[model samples]
Target chain A: MAELDEIIHQPLRLRIMAALHALPASTGLEFARLKKLTGATDGNLGAHIETLARAGYVAVDKAFVGKKPQTTVTATAAGRGAFARHVATLQEIIAGKQP
Target chain B: MIDSQQASAALNDINDVVHRVRQSRIYQNASLIIVMWGALVFVGYLANYTWPPQGYTIWAVVDLIGIAGSIAIAAFSGIGPGAGAYALRLLVAFLLFIAFGIFCSAVLGHFGPRQMLVFWPLFTMLFYALAGLWFGYAFIVIALCSSALIVTAYFYAGPALLLWMAVVHGGALILGGLWMRRI
Candidate 1:
């Protein structure tokens, strides 16, 4: 949950995680569509996504799709576990738990 | 300075975690919509018997198409985008509409008075709603507009249907556009 204090609350980060986690991993264009779906811009989505990738919570692969360089992102096992605990923590807090 | 780096790292992690949860929710919502639509289609078929024509054969064929298409979509969700699958959804929905027109006009012709077909718009509306909720808001809105046109042509005539259809289409697309923009 303390790790989540570092991760979840930012708008763009929330969106990138939401996108990658859903498809597990998808192309940069796919992520961009999700970003648009969640109303975030390219720079914003990239920066937040980079932060997660750097944390080892997400893994990003850069590859070629036809002639274009594409990035695909996926959540690590650690990332999934972290997210579940974070949700549990939030639920606990909602049910009147103290820090 | 050290605290600032730690804070930034913490925030990034939080975002990563929460976003995954949100996407999972969207996936779950999509599944629910599919289930609900299947149920609706089944019930609609049951009600189809009340109409003038009891051509179980054609209705069964139409129902198979619907059921197969729904299963294909459900299966495709697991296999990622499935290439041109999204476009196929639109094509399938359009074909269904044409079949609906043929079925109602030709087979159900003996419904006596046109007033009894009041269920036409209602049925089409429900279909569009199912498609919209399953596919996207745009699909539902467009389907509603198209189906309304069919209803108008059959039940009413002249420019009134045209004017009303314009209004219906305009309102649906406008509302859907605004909703998408909001999202």
Candidate 2:
């Protein structure tokens, strides 16, 4: 309950997780593009990524993309594991009570 | 700029609509594919009755194959969300069989086994080529090769067209499976 609660209870972080989880590895701008695609602002997206990084659900690395500060982010193995568990819980919710 | 929340909500709505549309298409196409196939069978039956071969029961066999093939398609459901795409491959394979049945029935009245069998591999090469638009070259090549082998082996026997068709779909399965790897 706590983990699933952690995953879906937050709005911006949920969007961040969902977007990156849906795609292959992506940079901050790519994540930003996804956020833009998914309808989240730069500030909101950055905040969520930080939250996920703090929670060890995401890992961020700083680098330069064409001389511009590029922050690359990926779901950590733990984060992916947590997301899978969260999804199973979601599926259980959709299925409604063990048959 | 669009409101992020609103855009997200709109996209969610769009996803829902797309989901419904896809379900509708699978259902509608299930029926449509059967009806189209049924029409083909009906024609085959008419040909059987109208052009009664008397000695050879091949027409009756062709008619039965047509009915059975269409029913199989309806039963298969051509893939769905729960099962992923493999079931679709089966459905498509059945469809290729249905195509083969049509080809067989068309020449049922007169064409011999050798000539009849040739249609599958050569044309399936083309069919798979066109399938390349939807499926690609590996699938096309697999279909072409498989169909050719079956036709070659049974080049002398009964309706060998189905083997060629098997290649079309066998290739599709092999190719579709590989293509799915990239995705």
**Candidate whose lDDT is highest:** 1
- Model 1 / residue B7 / CA error / Å: 16
DockQ of each: 0.15, 0.03
What's the lDDT for residue B1 in model 2? 21
lDDT of 1 at A84: 61
lDDT of each: 0.53, 0.51
If you assessed candidate 2 against the hidden native complex, which CAPRI class would it receive? incorrect
* Per-residue lDDT of candidate 2, residues B5-123 (tens digit): 43345345434433433433343433344344434434443454455454136445654665556455555543334333544565577578657756664756455644444443355
Q: C-alpha displacement of B157 in model 1, angstroms?
A: 9.6
Q: Output candidate 2 Cα RMSD.
A: 15.2
User: What would the per-residue lDDT of candidate 2 be over residues A1-99, giving only the tens digit for each residue?
Assistant: 323446433656655565555533332324544455446787877877888888888888878789888676777777767766765554444444322
Which of the CAPRI classes, incorrect, acceptable, medium or high, describes model 1? incorrect
The per-prediction tally of clashing pairs is: 13, 1
